[model samples]
Target: MENSTQINTEKINFSLEDLEQDIWVRLVTGAVKSRNPFHTPCVATMDKGEISLRTVVLRKALAKERELRFHTDIRSPKWKELSLNPSISALFYDAGDRIQLRVKGKAVLHYKNDLTAEAWKNTTSSSRRCYLTLHSPSSFAEIPTSGLSEEIEQENFTLAESEMGYSNFGIVSIQVHSIDWLWLNHAGHRRAFFDYTDGSFQWMIP
Candidate 1:
């Protein structure tokens, strides 16, 4: 039989073949989220001369495009910090799998009629619920949380959308500069780093 650890890694698309063909499944299906060791993104930023970190989701990744994306409210604190500084790092951990992907890149925000809107149009309604909240992100509010039910009376699907409420949608696209992927298998532990620059990739071990 194949080494179980190796098989598991492949199952998670940590292997070459999986990475090439199944990365989209790993992201869109939310399959990788549960399989992941880290429950959230360790997004690092500089806040007024001080370093800060927060948990965010991986959002979306287009394997073919070699791009990773995340969503946020324009009014959110992270948004302001990101606007001030475009360079950012996204850290991911998978506790059960002992796998991690640390991504460093220049984050570019997307707004209506630009790259961001195109991304927003692709998001699932479940994810879009976040943009419907009554209050702006990071805003002070009353004690109770009413959830999306109150604001979005109902949800209907469509192939096309309008400007009605799409303005609230914000997408963050990180043009990946480097991805440091590490894994702790049952027997063999390995770390590999890949850097993408100027339409080329450089792979190295660490």
Candidate 2:
């Protein structure tokens, strides 16, 4: 858990291309590794005239396609927002490297489809438990509870139990249109932008 600001920035001088590669490598690696800051990034979405932001776990990253994936309950408000507006943004920051990645993309929801099926199959039972809640997320309740009855909680955490969550489980695949990378350093901060949709990459004023 190194702080990005505390890194000895003087030791590394990265070219634009090199820095871009580093960002993707870290993002892809973070998707497979736990305890990495990039594993949990902030996702923002808009609905009507309002905006919302929340932290979501990164499930997959496809560099070739410039895509990122995350899992969520289909009943959540985020899903409602995304349904109305597919355009979205995500932010990933590595304090140890003094780097921040801002990604803009269009989100495609997958449910009751091959993509969702594959993702659900690979999901751990513990994670699947979230989709098994009796009530939709953020619903008002008389008492604060996980929304699972004691009987359901006592059941074995096996594939059989996970199957019950299939209806609520979903995957959000984001087609990245651009990525803005910023790095803070003692000498001078650097900023670069990569636009996949327009096929352009260049440095920008920080």
Error of 1 at 139 (Å): 1.6
Candidate 1 all-Cα RMSD = 5.7
Clashing pairs in 1: 37-94, 37-95, 38-93, 38-94
lDDT of 2 by residue, 67-87 (tens): 899999999999989989999
What digit string (tens of lDDT, one per residue) describes model 1 on residues 7-67? Answer: 3463433554444233233434332353443435778877788777887777667666666
Every candidate's CA RMSD: 5.7, 3.2
Candidate lDDT scores, in order, read 0.63, 0.85
Which candidate comes out best when scored by lDDT?
2
CA lDDT, candidate 1, residue 181: 69
Q: What TM-score do all the candidates reach, one by one?
A: 0.68, 0.91
The top-ranked prediction according to TM-score is 2
Clashes of each: 4, 2
